[model samples]
Target chain A: MIEEVFAVGTSRIHRVDPRHRVVFAAVFSVQTAIGKEPAALILALAAALVLVLAARLDARRVLQRSVPVLAFLMLLWLVLPWTVPGRPWLTTGPLSASMEGVRLSWQISLKSISILLALMALTATMTAATLGHALHHLGVPEKIVSLLMITYRYLFVIEAEFTRLWRAAKVRGFRPRTNLHSYRTYAYLVGMLFVRASDRAERVYAAMRCRGFKGKFYTLAVFPAGRDTVWFSLGMSGLAIAMAAAEWTATV
Target chain B: MDRTDPIIELKGVSFAYPGGPQVIRHLDFALHKRDRIGLVAPNGSGKTTLLHLILGLLKPSEGEVRLFGRSMRGEKDFVLLRTKIGLLFQDADDQLFNPTVIEDVAFGPLNTGKTREEALAISRDTLHRLGLSGFEDRITHKLSGGEKQMVAMATIVALQPEALLLDEPTVGLDEKTHKRLIALLAELALPCVIISHAFDFLSATTDRILTMENGRIVLDEEMRVHIHEHAHKLGSKPHRHV
Candidate 1:
């Protein structure tokens, strides 16, 4: 699911060094999260939208893939207006909605969407391996980087195993229902998956040791920070500075 | 580097898990330069365990493992030896942990202290040799079973090991890829000890076939003899296996 949602393509954003992209995304996300000015938030959203367009990403697909997150944002919109105390804007029977609460919800949703769009435009343009290598070069801990890379590599294998087991159960006439037997079977299924994964882990470790794996994972992927990458990062930084300036002026 | 020196030797090797039955007992095996040996055994017959012992991945309870005239007694010893002897695991997934094919193939050379560019050059050469020149950027998980197996071999072969220890190298491969693998192994001419249940495949690629049963080497003979005599089980009609 993550793989398809973050599908890569050959675009200008894709050509930028993953390390630079990661940094740009991080800085942009931080600014978007803390900026309170509506104009600045809209500018952040516009920047994210520009990135999305420059990358040639499909808007419909991105929005469709982001449904779950959008649903959570919708829930915030539904509850915040009633719970936060402010000037009442609308009322329905015993419940009253507040203008401040609605504005707060709008800020959160827009900021989150902007951050998500920025991530899709930057980090998601590269393969997970590239991103992991970029993170390593950016001073991420070796252990955490390895964990991320290995998890990305094996997630599909685990999913395949799960599908295989699920099929086996289906072949044996198993059906999902709210019963003790169904619950027990599902529990057993999850338990067996972990047991098998652990067993495979031991064998894989032995294989790795046999091949001279000495605690650290070495990578050959190089994300050279070239002219294009520098220019792209500078452009994003300029936009981010403009957003921050707008926020400060609004506060002043 | 004497011609008579064994690439690998295991003397009086015996191993078992804690509180478990001995998986390999008093096993003695040796491979010389240019030796091509095949080990065939049923499940739970210590084939993989013996490979591990030879590589020092699993230390024997009672034995000495020698690699390239050096005794493997500690982690440092094994680390040095592994660069000379590559072991291909039964499952390609187990052996391949990198996100892309090139990285997985380059991992061994990189870990053995090659510079990134050198490792990549070696990996690319190995992949080209394995008929996978354009697969460097392909996601390892998304590869076909046969492609994965070939890539796993490429990983080890990139290290340019003097010897190879393969465990069920052709388990999930199609016939065409399987034949290609047999051809590739034959051409490499490295001293190799292969553990596989595919008797026909072993016959095609190996010089001598050894049968292990109950933790001991029970049969050792030329591949032709092994194939001709035991082509079929009792009460089974004999047919041409073309």
Candidate 2:
């Protein structure tokens, strides 16, 4: 039910060390998110596009994945241009679009898209399990890494349980409609899902204990450090620094 | 511990959940080496609770749990005992918490302090032994029910546990997988306390059978299959009975 559509690949980006990808994704995302200059944002976005191409990701799938962010950006475009109280760039029929507001909205849209594409091309190229291991190797807290790994593992199980419960409801002449009864039925279904999930959590914990879990999750994954990983890290670092320099120069 | 000593011993064990009635009542049980025992019980008969108590997942309010002739009183002791006694949960999903099949299978060995390389080797070996040679990189959740069950078994067996506590191992299995499970169980030399409802499966795999009711063992007998030929009504043809 939970598909990792982008995880399976045989490209240069896929072969890079997950740790390098994770760290560079963070560095590039942070730089893009904080950068105010159009020049830096455009550079970041272009770099992200290059990474996407290098990863050989399907352009159609990438666009499909970007739909939610694009929708959010559309909302921002609708609201921001008229609300920020600045010199009017356009006035029509009692609605005025402010220059500063439009600029702010544009910057946010660029930041969001650049970060999203970069993350998809880098971190999403590996499975969640690999990402968890990478985070651990990067000195993320053990508890957080454990939570990520365990949550990823059981998300599918809980989804399957929800599907079964929904099927049972459907088989019992239960057609959801716009009514109090339907609302109550959906609430009960969600409540039961939570109850079942918690019950399964207890059983899973017991099973872990039976297998000698001692409050520490040991990962068998190894991210081998190679020349490509080193070069990728250096190259990404250089690009990130360049983006930051452009943002500073534009600010000055 | 002597070879004759019980691998797992429960003495006067009685347990109740907080604010709940007793699920296990003055239960005394022992599992010795070379004993492949099948335990049959009705729903809510506390067969699972009993296994949990033995594994120290649930503590007994009245009695003590002894593992390998040593009394295990606290969490620390059970941590060590768990490496020696593996329990296969009825739901494979509960047992497999890792993303990939090999990682899930290697989890036990890793938890027991094996190096990553050693654990991977053990996991590969275990999967190979279970006829899942090429399933190393498969996502655990994407596997079929029977395959998941076998992989769960591989996780437990990878630890090289001395005994196994299997809860309803044959549930949700197809005929072929069920036959394969029986064959696998027969091949394992470890003593097993299998809680199952399938009488024929128990008879085929175990040497001793136990029936539990009301949180206690009601019948203990040698595992035997009685076959007879019988005719139904006047004109019906005779058929072999199981």
Candidate 3:
């Protein structure tokens, strides 16, 4: 059901609450960056992989999203271990790059992956409205939250208008064949969209005001957070417990 | 009749768009209390524009549009005017913008600074009247057109506006929905002016039928005594006879 809201496939990942995934992602990034340690960093990667499997999300789909960071990580692994100088394990040439930089870049890659994975996992499992309600109850500023809500609400309307304009243009044989012409076409398209949107905004504002819209947007009462709240709390504490266990293991 | 004069009396009113053609030229009409009038005209014959003029949405170019005996001027006039006259647009999609159906109905009262509880109560009361007592949480856009139109009427009635103006309220409704709406309108005793094209529906429902030709009222006659008795025997519909 949550998967339907977020437009994600009905996987185990979608079954977990959105807010829990967010908190878990936050803790994973923070605890993994405690020291320049590869083992802890690999542990973070292993956790992300395990989450992917549990969620039943296709591995290729997940890796496709991580392509850019993965390429960067592979490059850093080659150059950093060869360059950064500390105690020279395999003395290369006279370049004398630091081994600490090598370790640091490795940690950076893992940290980036952990954060990215967590965010994608969370977003794919929640609707923008649920995230907004979460923000609204968590003491976030009203203006920002309402603005984002309105933006999300009206995006479909604006896009529908654009689609109409595009269909009309296509009928008139508008084709891009050169860079300059393409740029000009894009500029014209944006300009027309802005003017149309402004006119629509004026009429919509007038109609709304006539209906007695003061300033603030209001909604019917929200549902109780309930069991989802308990799950989020448990997930955060679970992450903390895992981090403590990692520290104890490292010391031993 | 409570020993009072006509609720809305407009004597020899004339209006035109600024630097444009006359949309309501030399219009003369008087609406007494509980007058259920239907104004019918062909497309581009200034039906909706005339309703706008009556609601004090647009000022007369030359003559008077007195609402309850006071002359309307500007913002204050409009504000006072809106409190008395409510307009239901042809497109209910334009009227209802709130996410939930209940919130959409509550907008009018809340905008007037009613307490949240008061707004909720008014919305509930209006819904109950409209036979939608349990549909408070449905999304506005998801409603069918007939449902949307009924909700729009519900929102206006919540304000308890004395005069209600509905522009083409049943253009595309099914026959069953249309008959049901006519019954609902007949039950509500507010002074209403329904702008529509269905003459038989208008003849069946309205107390008086008014015709507009070239932005002017060409004919006004009582439904039972004048139009059906005399006009039906003499010739044809309002457009043919007038």
Best by lDDT: 2
**lDDT tens string, model 3, A93-135?**
6655565766677678878887667666655555555556556
lDDT of each: 0.86, 0.88, 0.69
Q: Which DockQ value does candidate 1 get?
A: 0.75
TM-score of 1: 0.93
**Tens digits of lDDT, candidate 1, B139-189:** 999999999999999998988989999999988887778878988988898
lDDT of 2 at A46: 92
Q: Give candidate 1's error at residue A83 in angstroms.
A: 0.8
**CAPRI grade of model 2:** high
Best model number under DockQ: 2
Candidate 2 segments whose C-alpha is farther than 4 A from its true place: B220-223, B227-242
As a whole number from 0 to 100, the lDDT of residue B178 in candidate 1 is 84
RMSD of each: 3.2, 3.0, 7.2
lDDT of 2 by residue, B99-164 (tens): 899988988888888998899899999998888899999989889998999899999999898999
Model 1 spans > 4 angstroms off: A225-227, B1-3, B220-242
Q: Individual DockQ of the candidates?
A: 0.75, 0.81, 0.27
Residue ranges of candidate 3 with Cα displaced over 4 Å? A1-4, A7-146, A164-196, A223-225, A237-252, B1-22, B25-30, B53-70, B80-84, B128-135, B220-242
Two-chain DockQ for model 3: 0.27
